[model samples]
Target: MGALVTLELPDDSPIHDLPWIITFGPLGDDDEWEPVVCGPYERPHALALAESVVADEDLMAVVEPLLPRLSADEIRGEIAASRIAAEDDAVQTEDADIYGDYEDLLDDEPGPETVQQHAEARPAPSPEELRAGMARIADKLGNLSG
Candidate 1:
């Protein structure tokens, strides 16, 4: 069994030299259930231990850095910045004419007129001609069977 490892920083250089942790929990959408976290282990050791522990169990193990908890104000500021970035992207998309050149190319196309002309060049076979062709096929099939 393999462990799913997500690293926010380089393996050797954790923030303030903090330790890594192995978190095990349900692989379902159970929001109320809390995950069991074990560690303060070195990065490499945590990963190996996590893999061996979850090999026989039906749980998922995640190996990540154990960073200091964020304050409520910091979280709110991050959310505000994300919202501003999204709004700026929406405004830029609205102001820019992304399809202007594509619309011109569409207009330059010859449309279905050329296809209709090519199809019109070939006339449909007459009823008598079609009957003769069918008769020829039937005769060939009968000869093959004999």
Candidate 2:
């Protein structure tokens, strides 16, 4: 975790944290040659993570697991997948229909209060749905629009 700072409007002028912030972390004791979190070098387990990031595997000795035994529900992985999905902005045939349906049913709802409440009441995806969606989304959305 990080510390929390609270500010009151009564302050003369509250400047945001310069909008952009760059943070650096010190390396660990045993990690002298390696920057586990980040650095100029690629990840220590680059060969292993190649499964997730690399295009070809034969170049490497063998395909390796990036981070075995991951919880699968970790927020960090979710965030990364979300970013990748965004970069793959291509759309699927069904996606437009899905978006239109969502907009019509929710965005164009009859009442503001009703739509707001429905938004809050929406349920999280079930584990099965999560796994299925992840499998499909991990494909780089190659089937989506160009």
Q: Which predicted model would earn the best TM-score?
A: 1
Task: Specify the highest-lDDT model's number.
Answer: 1
List, residue by residue over 1-146, the lDDT tens digit for candidate 1: 43465566654664525567889876655433678999767777887888888787666888877644244455568789999999999889778967454555444656455433344444555656766865785577568747
Q: What clash pairs does model 2 have?
A: none
Weakest lDDT window of 10 consecutive positions for candidate 2? 16-25
Off by over 4 Å in 2: 1-119, 141-146
Give model 2's TM-score versus the native structure: 0.20
The 10-residue segment of model 1 with minimum total lDDT is 114-123
Model 1 residue pairs with clashes = none
Tens-place lDDT per residue, model 2, 13-121, is 3332111112122223332231122111222233234333323321222221222223445656778998888766745536655545454454454543533333554
| Clashes per candidate (backbone, < 3 Å) | 0, 0
Q: TM-scores of the models, in the given order?
A: 0.40, 0.20
**Cα deviation of 27, candidate 2, in Å:** 13
